[model samples]
Target: MHSTVILIEFGAIILGLGLLGRFAGRLGLSPIPLYLLAGLAFGEGGLLPLGASEEFVAIGAEIGVILLLLMLGLEYTAADLVGNLKAQYPAGLVDMALNALPGAAMALLLGWGPVAAVVLAGVTWISSSGVIAKVLADLGRLGNRETPVILSILVMEDLAMAVYLPILTALLAGTGWVAGGLTLAVALSVAGLVLFAAVRYGRVISRFVSSDDPEKLLLVVLGLTLLVAGIAQQLQVSAAVGAFLVGIALSGEVAEGAHTLLSPLRDLFAAVFFVFFGLHTDPASIPPVLLPALALAVLTAGTKVATGYWAARRARVSARGRWRAGGALVARGEFSIVIAGLAVTAGIEPALGPLATAYVLILVIAGPLTARWTEPLARRLAERRRARTPGDPAHGRPAAEEATEPAPVPD
Candidate 1:
C-alpha cells in the first residue's frame, strides 16, 4: 500500500475505534464487540469495502497481546511466579487438558484431520483474561479471594500456552526443531529470561531509563517491550513472553501513585490492539471457518465455565463465587488469537485462523456479559443456599453488619 493510502486507512481506523468506544460505553458493553461489528460493516460484507485481511488484522492483534502481557508481567515477582504455579498449576493443567480433549473429539467427529483437530483443540483451551480482568475490575472483584485464584490460573495457562502455541504449530507444520531437546532449550531460555529481567532490567530502570521524565519513561517501556520481544524471536520463544516478564518485573511501584506510569500507554496500546482485531474480519466473505469457529467457542467457553466452577468449589468458595469463576473464564480474547496467529506464522495451517477468530469473538461477548451479571447471579444462589440451610449466617446477619463484614473472614 502507498504511504497516502496507509495514512488514510490509519485515520479511518482511529475514527471508527473512537466512535465504537463511545458507543460501547453508552451501552454498558465492551467496545470489542462493537469494534468487530464495525469491522463487519466496513469490511467486504459492507458497502465500504475496506478490504481488510484477516491475516493482517490478526497479526496486529497478536502484537497488541504482546504489549498487554508485557504489562501483566510487570505485576509479578519471583515468589508470585512460583505462587502462581502452586495456586494455578493443577486447575490449569486439568482445565486446559480437558477443554482440549472435547474440542479434539468434536473436530475429529467433524472429519477434520488430526493436525487440524489438535490445533483447533489447543486454540479452544484458551480463555480470554483481558475481558475477564476488565469485568472483574469493573464489578470491584479484582481483589476478591476468588478472583485471585482464577487470575492465578489464567496467568499460568497463558504463560504455558504462549510457549506451547509456537511449538505445536511448528510440530504440525513439520518444522524440524522440537525433536532436538527443544523443551530443555525452552526451560533454559525461560530461566535466562527471568535472570535477565531481574539483574539487567529490574532494579535499574528508574535510574538508567531516566524515568523521572514522562517521555523518557514511555520510551523506556516501549524500548524494553520491543527489545525483549526481539530477543524472544531469536530464542525461538516469543517476544510477548519476554514482554510479560518485563511487566512482572516492573509490577512493583516504580513511583508512588494510584496507577502506575504505564497506565495511559497500556490503555492506548490495548485499544489499538483490540480495535485492530475488530478491523481484521471481513463479513462479506465470512470465512468458511466461522461455523467451526462457533463450535469451538461453545466447546471452549462451556468447558471453562464448568471447569472453573468446579475448581472454585474445590477451593471451598461460595456457590456465588463458583459462578463468578465460571463467568470470569468464559472469554478468550487477545491471548487466544495470539496463540492461534503464532500457529499460522509457524506454518501450521490457514483454517485455524478463522476458527480461532470465531471462538475469540464468541468468548469476548460471553465473558463480559457473564461477569456483568455475576453478582446478581451469585446473590440468587446465595439466597437459595440460605433458604435450604434455614438460619444460614448470610440471612441471619443484619444488613448493616454484613456490609461491614470483611468477606466472611475467608475461612
Candidate 2:
C-alpha cells in the first residue's frame, strides 16, 4: 500500500510538472518559476502536501543539482574557461562587487549574522546560467556580440563556485579555521588537478568514455558523474563541483554525446530539485519576508543589469547590446536555491530560506521580461531624449536647421 501510494503521488507530481512546463512554454517563459510554484503548492502548509514521495523527490533533487553542474561544465572547454578567467576577471570582480554586496547588506541589516550574510550574498551574486542560456537561444541572441561578455561573467562565477562551495560547506559545518583552510586547500588542489588533466588529457578522457552505443554511453557517463560527485561530497569538496570537473575532463565527442543523452534527465531532476526546495520551505513563512525579498530583488536586478552593462561596455559592445547583456543576467534560479537549501539544512536562520525563495521567485519571473524588453525600453528612452535635443537630426532637426525653419507640425 505504501509503495502504491508513493507511485501514485510521484506520478501525479511528474504529470503536474509536465503540465506546468507546457503552460510556461505557451507563454514564452522559462518553466523554473512554475516548477517552484508547483513545489510550493504541494509542500508543507500548502494546498496538497505530499508524504509518500518526499524521500524519492529528495534523492532526485540531489541528482538534479549534479547533472545541472555537469551539463554546464560540458558547455565550455578548459581552454575557454581559462581564457575567460584571464580576460574577464575584472568584470567578474565588478559583478561580485555590484551584486553580492546588496544581499550581504540586507542580511546584516536583518541581523542574520555574518555567516547568513555570506550565504545570502552568494544567493544574490550568481545569475541563473540555465535560464539565461535558454532565453538567449529562444530569443536568437546567442550570436549577439555581447553574449560572450555575458558568458564570460557566468563562467567566472561557476569557476568561483569550485572554491566557494567548499568554504561554505566548512562554515556551515562549524569547522575551525584550520579545518576550513584544509578543506579549501583540498578543493583548490582537486580543482587545479582536474583543470590540468582536462587541458592535457581531455581528448584521451573523451576517447575512454566514448562508446558507439547510446545506452552504454549514457550509463557510463551518468555513473561516473555520480561516483565522482559522491566522493567529492565525502571529501567536503562538493558533489556538484566534482561532477563538473568530470564533465570538464571529457572533451569532443564524449561531452557532446553525454550532453545530448543526459539533457532530459537533467531537466527532469532539475525540476525535482526545484520542487524539493519548495517542498521544504513552508509557504506560510514567505509572506513575512515577502517585502524584504521584493526590495532585495529590485535592488539586485538593477545591480545585475549594471554588472552586465559594464561588462558588455568593457567588451566594446553597442549600447543596446549592453542593455541586453545586463537584462539577460538578472535571473537567479537553481544556484540560489541550492545555496539557501544548504543553509536551511544547516539550521541557519529560519527566515533566510523563505526570503531567498521569495527573492528568487520574483527575479526568475521578471528575468525573461527584462531580457526581452530592457533593450527596447532603453532605445525608446534614448530616442525620446534625442527628440528633445535640437542637435540630433535622427529624432529632430539639427540646431541650426531648427532655428532657420518653422517648427515641424506635431506628428
Candidate 3:
C-alpha cells in the first residue's frame, strides 16, 4: 500500500510538471518559475502536500544539482575558463562588487549575522547560467557580439564557485578556522589538479569514456559523475564541484555525447531539485518576508543591470547590446536556491529561505521580460531626452544606429 501510494503521488507530480512546462512554453517563458510554484503548491502548508514521495524527490533533487553543474562544465574547455579568467578578471571583480555587496548589506541590516550575510551575498551574486543560456538561444542572440562578454562574466562566476562552495560547506558545518582553511586548500588543490589534467589529458580521458553504443556511454558517464560527486561530498569539497570537474576532464566527442545523452536527465532532475527547494519552504513563511524580498529584488535587479552594463561597455559593445547584456544577467534561479538550501538545511535563520524564495521568483520571471524590453525602453528614454534637448545633436540619433553606421564610405 505504501509503495502504491508513493508511485501514485510521484506520478501525479511528474504529470503536473509536464503541464506546467507546456504552459510556460506556450508563453515563451522559462519553465523554472512554474516548477517552483508547483512545488510550493504541493509543499508543506500548501494546497496538497505530499508525504510518500518526499524522500524520492529529495534524492532526485541532489542528482539534479550534480547534473546541472556537470552539463555546465561540458560547455567550456579548460582553455576557455583560463582565457576568460585572465581577460575578464577585472569585470568579474566589478561584478562582484556591484552585485554581492547589496545582499550582504541586506543580511547585515536584518541582523542575520556575518555567516548568513555571506550566504545571502552568494545567493544574490551569481546569475542563472541555465536560464540565460536558454534565453540567448531562444532569442537568437547567441551570435551577438555582446554575448561573449556575458559568457565571460558567467564563466568567472562558475570558476569562483569552485572556491566558494567548500568554504561555505565548512562554515555551515561550524568548523573551526583551521578545519575550514584545510577544506578550502583541499578544494583549490583538487580544482587545480582537475584543470591541469583536463588541459593535458582531456583527449585521452575522452577516448577512454567514449563508446559507440549510446546506452553504454550514458551509463558510464552518469555512473562516473555520481561516484565522483559522492566522493567529493565525503571529502567536504562538494558533490557539484566534483561532478563539474568530471565534466571538464572529459572533452571532444565524449563531452558532446554525454551532454546530448544526459540533457533530458538533467532537465528532469533539475526540475525535481527546484521542487524540493519549494517543498521544504513553508508557503506561510513567504508573506512575512515578501516585502523585504521585493525590496531586495528591486535593488539587486538594478545592480545586476549595472554590472552587466559596465562589463559590456568595457568590452566596447554598443549601447543596445550593453542594455541587453545588463537585462540578461538579472535572473537568479538554481544557484540562488542551491545556496539557500544549504543554509536552510543547516537550520540558519528561518526567514532566510523564504526571503530567498521570494527574491528568486520575482527575478526569474522578470529576467526574460527585461532581456526582451530593456534595449527598446532605453532607446525610448533616450529619444525623449533628445526631444527635450533638441540642441544636443549627439542625442538626435539612436546610439545603436550611430555605433553601427558604416564609416561614411570614403570618397
Model 3: worst 10 consecutive residues (lDDT sum) = 402-411
Please give, for residues 303-332, the per-residue lDDT of candidate 1 as tens digits: 787877887777777666776788688777
- Give stretches of model 2 more than 4 Å off: 392-411
Task: For residues 168-191, write the lDDT of model 3, one tens digit per residue.
Answer: 888898999999999999988877
Candidate 2 structure quality by residue, lDDT tens digits, 46-89: 99999999999999999999999999999988888889889999
- Among all windows of ten consecutive residues in candidate 2, which has the lowest summed lDDT? 402-411
Q: Sort by TM-score, best first.
A: 3, 2, 1
The candidate with the higher TM-score, 1 or 2, is 2
Please list all clashing residue pairs in model 3, or write none if there are none. Answer: none
lDDT of each: 0.65, 0.90, 0.89
Where model 1 places Cα greater than 4 Å from the true spot, the runs are 41-46, 51-62, 177-188, 195-201, 204-210, 255-261, 275-292, 343-350, 374-411
Candidate that scores best on lDDT: 2
